[model samples]
Structures are given as structure tokens and as C-alpha cells.
Target: MIVNLTTLDQDQAIEQISQLEPQLFGTSAWSPNAIRQELNAPARTYWADIDPTTTPGNPVIRGYAGIWFDGYDTQIMTIGVAPQHQHHGIGQTLLQQIIDQATADHAERILLEVRVDNTPALTLYTKNGFTRIGLRKRYYQPEGIDAYTMALPLNPHTIGFQPTHA
Candidate 1:
């Protein structure tokens, strides 16, 4: 099920993020403090994918994503699905939420950067109509990985795109 990240979910989300950080972001995972600060930021909105079937105190978070919007544009700050929960449309659900949020905020466009080597993420973004607009050299620090800058225009008459299905 989809839900906004609440104060009650903070500790659990942080724990899940910590476990996936090394695998998802390699050496560039955001620190726990950094994640907390981002979640508390005024202009940021984050959401979590949870299993509604779980018991009260043991809620399972399958994935999480965040975006930063400033009225004009929205940038996807982070997105990840637990390894075991991947390939189950969770990532697409999280991404669609951000797209909808950007549309609601009247953003002109949505932007994000992904490592050039992450084929799965690249495929997901491309399928959602985000086009490669530019590149940032060595964007991922410590590892010296380059990134592709992508954007999805949010024209008023065409605020969102249809999700492609195979």
C-alpha cells in the first residue's frame, strides 16, 4: 500500500534505507542523518511503499522515494526498492506518485539524474517519457561515475504521460 512517511515510520524507513544503501548506491549512500534531514525538509515530499498485511508494529516497507519541488520544477532526490521487492512494479508506483505530485504543484518539468551504468533505472525512466537532456561529468563522487540528466516536460495540456506496458 502507498502512504506518506510519518513520524511513526521514520525509524523503520531509516533502517531499511541503511540496509539497501550499499547495494543500491554503492559508496554514495546518504548518511542516516542526511536522510533524516531530507525527510524533514520543507520543500521535499517523500512516500513509502508498505505491506498493509503486516502487523501494527512490524510494518514492512518495500520501497521509498522522495522529490524536491520549488513551484517551478521538481527533482527526484532519491528512489529505491528493497532488493527482494524489486521487479514487482513498486518502483513504478513510487515514480508515478512523484509525477502526480509534480503535476499537482504545477511544475514546468520533472528532472533527475541517474548513473549511466544503471540500466534498469535508465529503462524505467525512459519508459516514463523522461528524455536524456544533458550529462554531468563524474556526478557520483568517490566512484567517479558519470550521470545522465533527464527531464519530463509537464505542459499544462499534457501534464502526464501514460505508463508504457510490455
Candidate 2:
């Protein structure tokens, strides 16, 4: 089942991330230092797939998602599902979990930058109610590619926040 990403799972996440490095930041591989840096970043939230306690088949650590807080709003740091695990609703599941947390943290909105070339991920965010707010020129590092700025309004129901009168 899906759950919050853990500090103990850093090693496994790093290893898995290495395998998919080519997908992001272009063909240049990432260093262990980079992986550790990401895992230990301040004000970051991460979620991971775990070994199902009541099910069969190797859990294999499907994927992970993360976000960084910017005081006023939360910025989506990164989100990815293992290639074999794509299209199984894992992306949506991970995103939902993060959205829940962000809203709980009192974030008014969630923002992210995605490569314009990433059609599937863009579609996924769009389908999940994220709207394109603007464009960032050469936003993706190492690739010098533009990214679409996406924002998702956090509904109170999704994060269990109820307002009260003074």
C-alpha cells in the first residue's frame, strides 16, 4: 500500500532513483550526493510505496513523490512512478496523498513546474484539477527546457480542514 515516505527508506529510494535518472535531467546521471541531498532537503515531504503486509508479489518499491515548502505555498519538488508501475493510478494516489498533506499544512495552493514535453504527467495533473498558471522559460536544469507552471487549489474537504466562526 502507499504511505508517507520515510527517512529510513532513503537508501532504497536513492537506489531506485538512480535507475530512473535518465528520465529526468536528461541523459546525465545523478550522483549519490544529489540523491542524499534531495532526501535531506529542508521542509520537504515525501511519500513511498511499501511492501503490502497482506498481499503477495514483490512490493518492489513502486515510486516516490516529494514537495518543498515555500512559507506561503508548497512547491512540488518531484513525482515519479517506476516505468513498469506507470498508468496504474500510482501517480494519482501519490499526488492525492501529497495534496492532503499540503492542505493540512494550510497551503492555499500547490505549484509545480513540468517539462512541456511531458504529455502524460501534464495530463495527469490536469485531470486531477491542476490548472496551468503560466510558463517558465528554461526552467528544467541541465536540459534548458521550458516548463509549464501548474497550480492546484486545495479544497478544504480534501484535507479535512473545517473553518469556525469567532
Candidate 3:
């Protein structure tokens, strides 16, 4: 249940992102306007995870994931699942879709950062072959939380590892 976030789907995407801010960042980290600005940015490529069979205006944007691919390895800008939709494989599905899109777009790798304390998200990323590569101190604002940087190298010829965290 994944699709590209085209211009026509701007408003819907904004609404969904706004709804996730409170629970995700524990604050109004992303407002509709802020989301629109980023989603509509000329330099970024956005994507949405809607029910694969749904139509426009009726799209079930339970989770939103986006990347900023500047014609190179994509940077996963943001990813969030609806509070009620968390831990139901929605995050994994969204990440896979983004990975597929990155592959289709000819990206050699995909990079992202997750809050160091976000175990569920870290698990999802680790299970998708993304490895911890670095750290971003105080990556999240407000109270200044840090994040772990991760990247997934894409190559069918190479063995992909999906580590299961205990």
C-alpha cells in the first residue's frame, strides 16, 4: 500500500503528517503548512503509503514516508505510522516500498536517522538491512534528543543482512 506523493495529493499528505506529529515527536513537530512546504519542495521526492487499492480522495494514508533524493543516495527525511497503526507491519511495509522506490530510482543506498530511544523504529530499520553507520547528536529539537544514523546498501549481487534485535 504505497504510492508516490504527487502534486495532486499534497493536501491529503499534509493532513496525515499533521495527525502523526503529536505522538511521533511528542509535540507539534510538523504542521500542515510545514509538511506542505517540505513535500512541495522542488529538491525533494516525496512518497505516500496508502492502501494499494484505494483511489484518490479516499486514500488511506495510515503512514507517511518520504525521501530527499538529490540524484544520489536517498535521504529518508521522515517516516511515521499512525498511532493506532503502529506495530502492525505498517512501518515495515512503508520502508520496503521506499526501498523499492529507491532501487527503481537507481539509488545505490538509502540513508536515514532514527531517535536513539525509538526501539521499534530501530528494529524495523535493522530488519530491513540498514546498518548503523554513525550518529547525529541532538538531531531532534525541542529537548535535544540524539539519533542513530543508518544506511542500507542496495545490490542484488550482495548478500543482504536483516538482523533481529532481541
Candidate 4:
């Protein structure tokens, strides 16, 4: 139930991690300050999926995602759905938002690293056209889990790029 996807503001940023950190990232959860910095970064885009049908003063954040754009390339910084809300296409909606933002910013491709053992994440990325391009040994900290690097090439034409006559 994707109602309106909104940029995560300062107040919401704190709430985001507080509510979903333990459930989504476990021990590797990012600090609220870090999230604030990311939200304020010039080259980053972050969005929160809100379900408007929820009760007043208690908005439910279905999911959230962020991306970093650097001219011709984009990297997915993070994407997650609350444990209770998983497998409901909210993740896909969040992913598409980042892809759209990257495309609008003229990114030629998107890249991300996912824990190798996370089958659901791998499945979602693969379904969305991301392919395994490389691997990072022990990329995840503390637990020392390996990671798979994936990339998705974007079509310039589909991103609304128009060539100008010289």
C-alpha cells in the first residue's frame, strides 16, 4: 500500500532508525546522527514509504531506501522494509524510487553490495535486473559475512535523456 513517498526529514530520520534499526540492521544499525548526515548530503536521495491509512499522529513507515549519485554512477546506500511488512512489494517501490532518482540525475548505472546469504534481497535485486558483478570477502563487519556486488545498467533513452543539436 504505497500512498505517498516522502523525503525523510530531520524529525522523521530519528524515528526511522529508532523504529526499524533493530529489526532491519540488527547490530550494524546506523546511528541517528549518521542518518541525519546522509539526509543532508548533497548527492544523496532518501525516501520513506508512508501508509496514509494509519491512525492520525502515528504514521506507519512501510519501508525506506537511499541512493548516492555521482555523475554517471549511482550506489544504493540502503533499502529496507520492517520485518512485519516484508514481502509486500514495499521494497520494490522503494527501490524504484531510487532508480528513478538516479535516472533523473543522469546516472548510467546503479551498484550495491548485499550479504551473500540474504536470499530474499538477492532475489529482489535479480528480479529488478541487477546482476552479480563481483564479490567482497568478509564485507560485513563483526559477523564477517561475505557480500555480493551487483549492478544494474540503465538505458539513457528510457530515462528521458534527449540529445541536443550542436
Whole-model lDDT values for every prediction: 0.89, 0.78, 0.80, 0.80
Cα lDDT tens digits, model 3, 9-116, are 667667777877787878527877888888878667666667666776778777878788777788898888888878788888778878988898888799998899
Model 2 lDDT per residue over 117-155, tens place: 999999999998999999999877777889999999764
Query: What is the lDDT, from 0 to 100, of the residue 117 in candidate 4?
Result: 91
Give the clashing residue pairs of candidate 3, or none.
Answer: none
Estimate, for each residue in 17-77, the C-alpha lDDT of model 4 and write its tens digit. Answer: 5678768877767777777777778877777777768775566777878888888789999
Give Cα distance to truth, residue 166, candidate 4, Å: 17
* lDDT: worst 10-residue window of model 3: 154-163
Best by lDDT: 1
Better of 1 and 3 by lDDT: 1
TM-scores, all models, native as reference: 0.89, 0.81, 0.82, 0.84
Candidate 1, residue 136: how far the Cα is off, in Å: 0.4
Runs in model 3 lying further than 4 Å from the true structure: 51-56, 155-166
TM for candidate 3 is 0.82
Task: Spell out the clash pairs found in candidate 2.
Answer: 5-47
Tens-digit lDDT track for model 1 on 57-115? 77788888999998888999999988888999999999999999999998999999999
- Return the top candidate by TM-score: 1
Q: What TM-score, to 2 decimals, does candidate 1 have?
A: 0.89
